[model samples]
Target: MTVEYAPGRLADLYGEPSRPTVLLWHGTQTDSRAAVRVLAESIAELGVGVIAADWDSHAADHGRADLLASVRFAQRTTAGAELVLVGWSLGGVTAAGLTLHAHAFGVTIAHTVCLGGAFMAEDPITGGPVLADIPASAFRAPFTLLVGTADDVIPVGAAEDFAAGLRRHDWPVEIVEVVADHGSIAGARYDAATDRYEPDDSAGTAVTARAVATHIVAVARHA
Candidate 1:
């Protein structure tokens, strides 16, 4: 599909952007500026470039719109370069939707990673829809999903079920379990000294941005 260009947004390029880049999508309720800055800074330590897209927070209401715009923005900005899309929480769902859209439009994703992805809709037994609705062919690229063992908000079982759904579609899926809580997924830590949340050195450390960056690069390398 042809990407309609939208101009005037900032893209945080790290490492040798001349190389393929990774696009970071932040979770719902979080803004792109801060989230991208943190993750990009960490991964840049490993010499990688990241293009973090800012979308309407209203996307929580209009998730489909957010997904299309983010993918289109990514497509236009990183044209011809290998791309790895990483999404957290609600953003993870957006990332998965983008993977399908991009594949359909003939764009190549180096890889896709969803962190504490809120992929499952609701408990199917509880009368809510399933979390993952995309087809297998949509996931034309290899993907990884990460969840915390002690995540109180997202049931680890749901994350596993999502992975199983991907496999049923014949999609290559890898699931990683980190030894942390939901806060640890974002690498957010409470500074009892400061009495506020601070960036935990160990936050997201278990699934360190470096590990995510390495996996994405590997996908691009093979592709």
Candidate 2:
């Protein structure tokens, strides 16, 4: 079921509260909880709690305030639990920013996963450099990047560059290439009639979800 952890911050929660929690963030121009609900459910099925929040990345504050609020909410609701941050598309960049600056917020992030993330360009909302320029010393946890081989939205080169940057600083990082696109990797499809998201049921979509869930569980084990 879904719960509101803060005003304007909602999460589609799955699994027991005691399980390790993944705070999932959505891409640009989408509601976080609804956009990634299916993928979150898939991860939750692996015996972890998935909490996807809603934030407007284009808001005046560049979604930073809301995203931080979501993190704080996750910390409060899932105290004593391992916390992993998962972000898709632009949200992935936001997650990276949060991880680099987590010390400022006094939060501990066990791990991070970015699916089809775009981290090379300047954040139009925040008007700052992206994750590619973050120093390795800034990261407080291990990170995984899930790139879609068929994704045309964000070039694979960007992912490679970000991974290289992290490796240069001797950070623990992994980049997994999946046979899916930007949307299918996260099991998202827009429904015109309902104006909401619908799940993608293709074989490729299943493979992508399973691969991502496996990585999340694996990372949590070592976190």
Candidate 3:
């Protein structure tokens, strides 16, 4: 169920906090945690703790504090269980920034996962756009990026471009091309009326979410 991780900052907690817990960060949509719920629950069902955080992407500081607050909550929940950071949409870029700058954040990420990431934007954590030539020296941990071939909102090549940049820097990274669209990868579909990604029960969506969850669990197990 969802709870307030900090004052006015909401989060959805899944399963019991354990070693190698996942911190699922959502996209820039105001729906926040809702955007990642379906996939988060799928991971939780496989016995991993997942915390899906809700933050204001339009906040004065772009909800950096809100994101960090949820991170702290995950830390407390895990009690040193180690963290696996996962990001969707713009959250992927921010998480990528945080992963590269992990030392500054004072967090050790076991593994990082990006889902249909939009990389051409400012990373709230680093306050800079994700450029192509970030030196390999800045690499802090391995990254697994999931790209959607059918994604309409963000082109697949965008993520491929970022993956190429990571490879150019010799950063440890893996890219998985999923045969799903933007929201279906997260077990959601955009609702024009609500302007949010609501839960989608289509058989195809379930398949996509399950595949993504399986990949996530594998990453966590090897972390």
Candidate 4:
């Protein structure tokens, strides 16, 4: 279903939210919900609800309002249920950054998953690097980084390094490497002409997305 997460902003909520809800955030290049259509459907089909929201990374406040708007919508509507957060690329860092202040926003996130995330860049929330002089008590939830082994955008080793850093601070984290590129890990392919990712229907795309979908459902079941 189409949802108005914020005024003049929209999101797609797949499956019945009466079940476990997973708020999916798209990456930086574009705030288009279509970018994650395939992955949302995949997760929804696994008996989980998925909210694929759009947030403009190029906004003046770096899309902070749009991002938190979705979180508020999710929190108030779900009644503090088992809501898992998933983000890709820049959105991953943004989601992780929110953990530093979830209580301030009045939300309880069960778990967070970052897929091919850009941990080295500035997150949308604090507009700073993710792991520099942050407190061990900053985060409020466990995290799982799904590293695409074939992702040339962010190397697997770099993801591991970030996870190691998180672990050093006692942030519960796990690394699950998948055999796909940055885009295909979420059933998308980088479009050179538009400089963004678009959905692809290849078998490998389904395979990789299914891998992520399974993990998300399993995590929600436990959360």
Pairs with backbone N, CA or C atoms under 3 Å apart (clashes), candidate 2: none
- Where does candidate 3 clash, by residue pair? none
- Put the candidates in lDDT order, highest first: 3, 4, 2, 1
Over 4 Å off in model 4, which ranges? 133-139
lDDT of 4 at 7: 88
The CA lDDT at 194 in model 1 is 48
Give the alpha carbon lDDT tens digit for every residue of 15-91 in model 1: 65634667777665533434545555666666666666655445345444444555566666656776777776766
Off by over 4 Å in 2: 123-127, 132-139, 190-198, 202-204
lDDT of candidate 4 at residue 104, scale 0 to 100: 61
* Whole-model Cα lDDT of every candidate shown, in order: 0.60, 0.76, 0.84, 0.83
- Model 1 stretches with alpha carbons more than 4 Å out: 1-11, 59-63, 122-139, 189-223
Worst 10 residues of 2 by lDDT: 131-140
Error of 1 at 19 (Å): 3.9
Model 3: lowest-lDDT 10 consecutive positions: 131-140
Give the per-residue lDDT of model 4 (tens digit) for 1-223: 8978888899998887744589999888657788888999999899988889999999998888999899888876777675688989888888788765566666678888888988888988877887765654564588988988789998777678878888788888999988889998777899999888998778879988998889888888887
- Candidates arranged by TM-score, highest first: 4, 3, 2, 1
lDDT of 3 at 187: 75
